[model samples]
Target: MAEKKFESDAKRNERLYVLYYIFGAMFIILLGALAYRQIFMYGYYHKKGMLQTQRRIIQPGARGDIYDRNGRLIVGNRPVFDAVVYFNDARFDFRKEYARLNKLRKQNKEPFDYSKLAIAARTNVLQSYIDEINSILKTDFVLDADFNRHFSGRQLMPLPLVKNLSISQHAILAEKLRVDNSAVQIYTDTYRYYPYADRAAHAVGYIRPEIEQVDPDIPGDDLRTFSFLGKIGKSGVEKAFEDRLAGETGAEIWVVDHNGFTFEKIESKPPRKGGSMQVSLDMELQGAIEDAFPNRKGAAVALDVKTGEILAMVSRPSYDPNTFFPTMTHAIYNDIRDRGAWLNRATQGLYPPGSTFKIITALAGIKSGVIGPDTVSYCDGYYQVGSRKFPCHNRYGHGEVNLQQAIEKSCNVFFYEHGQKMGIDSIAKTAKEMGLDSPTGIELHEESTRLTIVPTPEFKRKQGSGWSKGDTANVSIGQGDLRQTPLQMACFAASLARGETRTKPSILHDTTRKTDMKYHGAKKLDIPKSGYDAVIEGMVNAVERGTCRRAAIDGVKIAAKSGTAQVMVKGRKLTLAWMIAFAPVENPEIAAAVIVEGEEPGDASGGATAGPIMREMFAEYFKGRQVAQ
Candidate 1:
């Protein structure tokens, strides 16, 4: 009995020994794994953890401000909130759920395409979320197709579902998102704001939404995947100085929790603000000049003759640049574009100079020795050129007239004879020297300075055509291909006032400039002072008692010339009325050019149409000067 009991004890001891060996082996394996993790594998795990919890965020800075010459704010930026969706994060959560189902389906031994099922499930989830958002915001959020496309093409970018959100809308979205911790985000952003609405709409310009990459070779850790870079300038001064106006981008380091909620800010660098712009624009005078125009399809410009400083420039039928922001409605865009409202007519509209070209022709004839100051020409209602009668503006001409009287009366016969005598080449040379064939060098991006038609023998030769007596007669009267922008005419009038060519026309204020304003190239006309006085006398006489009598002011002496040009518009004949003038002629302060387009055939001459506008502009200038004194 004792031997059997001892044997039973030994059997129990053997079982205990077997259990101890197994536990000892397990402990050694666990200790080795701990040592390996703390040593060789530590860097890999630490990197993985950091990638999950730490993130880099980019912050976009605000655009700069724009101010007029009088220090009034013309353009600025305003804070806005945008509702966006980070599709990558949403896809991550969707795939996690899909993997759980995938495991269950695999356990059940079901044959199914995992990729196809995952896509269907993700689409349904996203649609349901959009439906919820729509209910809260009371909007029809139909972004299914756009979401699919963005997910395929730009998955890292945050898709902006709604921009420029109202305060109430933002509040509701924040509250709803807080409870569910959804992948949707509300980001703080900025959009351009024009306080004066349509005032200075063309000169100030507008902005549009765009993504700008600073450097494509930058490391991924330097920027956030879904950061919102603001809109960029699309036209006007905005486009002219885009680099100086668009601010620099910044970055932030954030520590996030396991659920992707940012818990702490590790480090941050604020964005740098852009530089402001100062332009030579007087809002008050601009409004006045625009209001003085007779038609809504023409242009007007007033210049400080001595300095070539543009005091006022007005292009009719202008559109509000603010309408371009946050996406313009198709109807409004089409309407404005169709009406030619986007055209800057002050420096871009091309029209015949009419009798104003007589100024250049008279100078050419005198300079070329084809005519003297006392050269007399007969105007018996018409002039004979190759059997065709070129009728004068005055059907019953001034019988016989000299240079001064012809200019005052705008007799076509006097200019016709001189133009044929000197030919188109002489006239074109004088015109080019007087700053007529080049741009005025204004700061606007839309200024157009296409070569004006001179119709010289060389010009005709290049066109596979030849000069004829009729062509010479037409060129003399500013008809046919002769075209000039109002800005050019203003410069011409200014040059006449200063007795030299002044080509610099700037939109930047002298006071705001950091350096001296560069000299715009000029040419000295060597004509005798008596010649200038003779032409000035005729222009003054025109305003005093001739056709431009409407432009004469009570206390100011204004030298003036009026022109009526014929043009074809939409298969219909139209007349463009023009007036170029300088006030207080002896010591001119302002030189102006005004044009009213698409006037009726019998609509009073340029004197009656554009003359009053010039008179009003000059009156305002003198009134301001008087008040200032």
Candidate 2:
């Protein structure tokens, strides 16, 4: 009996030892796992926790203001009022409503998706707030269609309930709502405002909303982020100076709860306004020129003859830029598009330069020694080229005219005779040297060089055709395959007045900019003083007692040329009336170009249509200045 008892005690002791050893090994393994997690995996788990609890928000800075040369505000920002709800402030209400709904579902023995139920509860709570706002402001506010997507993607940001509230409504909401502590708040944002309305709409341009996602200075690159809508330039000077006009981006580091609701902002940097810009446009001059247009489908441009700076640019059928802000509807967009108001006619509209191109022909003729100041040509109603007959404006014609008389009377026969003598190569060379074949390099994105052409034999040959004397006759009178913009003509007038071959136009204002600097490798006119004098004399005679009589102004000696060209549009023949001029002939100050499109045949003429408009522009420009007798 004693031996059996000893054996049982020994087995029991061995079983106890085995159990302790197993427990010891298990404890050691557990300690090793804890050490690995605490030491080696610290960074991974900490980053994951931070990503869940923290978020960064990006805010765009206000766009800069735009000013004219005279310091008048052309484009600026106006305060817009919005009614918004912060998701964080409504968290408790969301949880309570969700609990109530869940309980009701259970009691009714109905199956429901927890996520869907939560979303419904949130929507109901937001709707109740919107309803309260509607009662206070007498508005018809409702939840947006993308409310669920916004809630899921940007839970930490404020959702706008009613945007672009009127002044009266904004005041009512501000007075009745607890903006500081309530779930609903009044948020202030900016909308682009055009003080002058459509006066300089094309030059000032417009913007559209965009969101920025990346900011280098902000932390937490791997974390989720929320953003505010920012404006980006779409056209005109706004697009040209986008970098200078766009403001700096700001950031906020926020602490969020498990439900992704922001509870505290630990760090923040407010956005700064963009740099302001002062353009070379003169609003008063711009307005005056626009009002001077006699027709609705035309363009006019004025420039400072000394510096190539644009004084005024007018494109008719203009739109009120104010309509584009605070949200543009498809109706307004369609209306603008239908009216053809979106085209900047001054820079984008291509047309045959008409008689205004006579200036180029005269220069080419003189430079090639094909004609001189004393040259004379006989005009008896028409000139024959090959088998075609080109008639003059005056059927009977100016009997026998000198170079000066030919220009003063706009005798087409004289140019046809001289242009043929000079040949197409000399004419094309002069035109290209004058920059008629390229864009003016203005500070606008719409300027294109594709349609602007100074057609030559080479150009015609590439089109699988041969050049002819009829083509030369057509080009000599500025009618065939020769197209230019109003801005280009205006620049040409300025360059001619300054005795230069090219003018680089600019929309920015700089008083210190050199006026005599070479532009795009521009050189002097390369014509003798006698040649320039002859052309100037002819132009002066035209304005004083010739075709451009209507362009004459009291106490102002103007050098001007008028033209009438033909075009076929939609299978209908139309006329384009044009005028190009520079004022105070001896000391040129302003250069201008104007064009008027005819609605019917013979309805428009250079002197009858475009001359008066040019007169008005010059009258306004010399409004308060002393004029040379």
Candidate 3:
């Protein structure tokens, strides 16, 4: 019995040993799992999340440059350095940082002055950062409210380092950005700049923030890629050649760190730099023309009388366009807006051609053979048309004047007599053919118009006013239904010089785009050479010895006409000054038109206001040229 008990106890001892071994193995496994969890799972993941994100720096494509006919830079883009903050790269432990700073302050003997300490701390931080930056770069960084604003709003986004950097500085920054792989990065951002802003602001209009994405007519590229980029031209030549001035935008892959910092970059495409623009403008002439006006609002356009290429266009009271790039403030914008300073008055504003329209009437009369160059008309100080007596501006009638004398003296009766003979329809038709009733297609924004000549019953139905013969008589002298722009007047003078009726006036001249010069199935207006010559001679006489006597140039002979259109505002008559001139008399090279509005209620005339501007322009331009031998 004892031996059997011993055997059972031995078997039980062996089972107990196996069970002990199994329990010891399980405990060792559990302890290893706990150690692994404590060392590498949750804690490791959090540390991994704390690492700053690295993003690849993206380069913005440059906008094209704008130049004059001589390739002088009119408008261009300049680089600027801006401090940029990568939100994702920024440390997010603001509370912990505040606590640490508080501990540092307490450890020192500094008093509890939170405001002063906070300011000093911020300044110290900025200074330290700038100092470190200066260590790498040999330039200084300025800290201002703009940085504060960006910091308060977007700590992750990078702030501008420097604005309005020079080309040399831009080169330095670009080279540093490409070569250096430091933790902090700086890149170049270009802003629109106008070097000759005073010279061609009206012709090369300013830019504004576009409301949305700009899509070009060209295929193979998406304009949306530049949705956050610089804008194209908005007005004048800039607006006209916006497509050319704005190049295709390219994009790249930017790998960012956890804190949104720039890391490695993969270029998706190399952005195509925009092409430069060359306009048909002479900067010297433009400056001379702008200097011609003094303290008055006016416009002048000079066109190559032979080629229809615009040389210079001046609009007075023009706003400077240098403030348009990057962004503009409401105060500055409203200052320009309230004064109508930004309006391109030359092409967009309309006014009466005044006495200048008499040339058309003379042509119409001579073309109808109803009156000759020697046609005579007598005025008794005032001519009676039906029941109304129309007074000449002379206040005393120009009596017994022939067409040449009438043109030289601008006698209203000669034109009235001829207008009566030829009828108003003939004059309207002739003027329309001279590029009047529509836009001249000048590549600039314009508001062109046609007169309501002899408003028929159908016209009366459309408009509330009925046709009146008195209106037709007024239209004959450029009064009742007469309106034309300074650019249109310039174009008209150019047509007379070129001797053909094609008009394509513009300040922009792009070699890439071909100009359609043919008038395109347009009707031609025929006039007698004798009549045209007589009137042109009369214009020459006027400039030489009449109302526009002040417009004489030393070397070149300028055939010119003056206009003083009357406007009735609140029962008061206001005169708008006007002048149109073409130089060299026989073979004109340039033609110009100028106008100034809101004259002191009939206190000013075209000869006194607009004509003198032409004189100033001529005096400066014809400085040493020889016209008469």
Candidate 4:
């Protein structure tokens, strides 16, 4: 039994010995393979790296210019210098390289003291080495905290230390870099700026520092890896045509040495400049209108009746677009964002139409034959319909008045009855046909308007309610839920004047290149001349001796209507004053609408607030009149 056990132990030992030898051979082979790769691969890369070292300087392309119809420069670029860092090109162990400096300060001579040194003292370090560098550089080289966060994620890209550096600063950077060629490098680029300042800010828009969109043509393979892209328009025409305005950015190959110092070459594809935009804005007329609203808070839109060109569109409480370029700090943004400023009231703001909406009631009453030109409604300060009593604007009422007289005096009682007779459905349909309750479809973004139709079964399903006559009466008189933008009012007024369904208006008269606008669905519209004529006479009387008396321009018989509409925000009632009109009664050329909010006197009417601005715009617009220029 002892001999058999010894034999089993020998066999076990032999198997263990063979397994150990095999393991040793495999380990040595793996080590040798790693060594070979370390030598061969590193050798090839290191050699090529020598021929291709560089400072990794980057260039942001120039921003495009914006021109008005008259070819005047409304927006342009100014040269700016920036303090930037090329992280990948920064030599020395950024972590440890500075470590020795701090250590040296403890005992030995400090080799490089960036912190103790003044801004100029440190401008000549890292990638560049020259005398001229110091002379031209105006900014300090110390990295900022915000920059550090960006650099970590954007290691491959150069960091901008300062943006929109002034002209004097640019001069300093250029001269210094030329003379010294120091360690710190200067990057020059164009920053977006607006010459018009606030004149057309709402239309021209602004830009941000970081690019928001990469080229849509980027390949699937590279898209995931690319970290930064170019600018995006945030609002107005700027946002609407972002693709054309953002332009393109190019890429280059960067190589570095062990020190992470840039010492090689750069090969880059040149970036494509953005396209120039010719806005349909009438600078002269825009300026004139802007001049009219020096202090008042309001907006105005003047339309070309023969064609749908917006002659002038001015949103008051204007902000300098220059504030938005490069970057808009929280403080500056908050200052302008919702301060009743920034809002393009002409195209997007919805207001109660007041007496201006009486035309629609008249049209509905006329069309439905429920009320006639000769039909009379007595307004003894108030109107009675169902369980509701509506008041007339005169307070004492016009007593007994015809449809024309009711419109002339803007009698609310008449419209309240008209709303009851026409009902909500008929009023809604007529209002829609007259260009209310829908977006004017102006080029501006998210243009808002009121819904004319009362909530139907479908609307009820969505809103969880059935239609009511009271609601109908409310909307018909441009109260309750009835709202229309200044642009919509002008468009509808133009329709009433032209008798053809011309579109509301356009920011770009020459839309040959704007593919999106090519299919906007503009078509010829046919409506009964008598229906238009009836509305026209009412508007004419409105201007001759009615609510729109403020809009009367001497030498031109203005057919205008004014409205003092009630607006409620968060259930608090306020009045939004408005006026819509067309001029040169014999041959109409201009259609104008102005809306004013926050006017004093809760009883403030559109005729009082918007009328004068419209009158002023027309006086100047047609001062040197001729057959359509």
Q: Tens digit of lDDT per residue, candidate 4, span 158-207? A: 56655556777666765665564533456666667788789877777776
Better of 2 and 4 by lDDT: 2
Compute the lDDT for candidate 4. 0.67
> Positional deviation of 255 in candidate 4, in angstroms?
3.3
TM-scores for every predicted model? 0.79, 0.94, 0.76, 0.78
**Residue pairs clashing, model 2:** none
TM-score of 3: 0.76
Candidate 2 residue-wise lDDT at 436: 91
Instruction: Give the lowest summed-lDDT range of ten residues in model 2.
Output: 513-522
Better of 2 and 4 by TM-score: 2
Candidate number that wins on TM-score, 1 or 4: 1
Clashes of each: 0, 0, 31, 29
- Which candidate's lDDT is highest? 2
Q: Model-by-model lDDT, in order?
A: 0.78, 0.88, 0.69, 0.67
Write one digit per residue (lDDT tens) for candidate 1, span 582-618. Answer: 9778688788899988645666468988888888887
TM-score, predicted candidate 4 vs. hidden true structure = 0.78
Tens digits of per-residue lDDT for model 3, 1-629: 99999999999999899889999999999988887877758677554443333222223357688788878888887766654434333333333444567788889956787755554555455555456555555877765555556544444346555555556655665566556543345546667888876676888886665522433332323111212345656777767776677756554444445433345654465556678877888888888878777666778888877567888888778877777656788988899888778777787777777887777777778788877877899976777788987777787877898877787787887777677677767877777777677767777764444331322234545777776666666767777757788888888877765555656776766455443346322333466778778878888888888878878766677888888888776888888888888888767778888888864687668777887788877776567777662
The sequence of per-residue lDDT tens digits that candidate 2 reaches over residues 284-388 is: 888887887865688988989888888888888888878876778999999999989899888889999999898899999999998889999999999998888
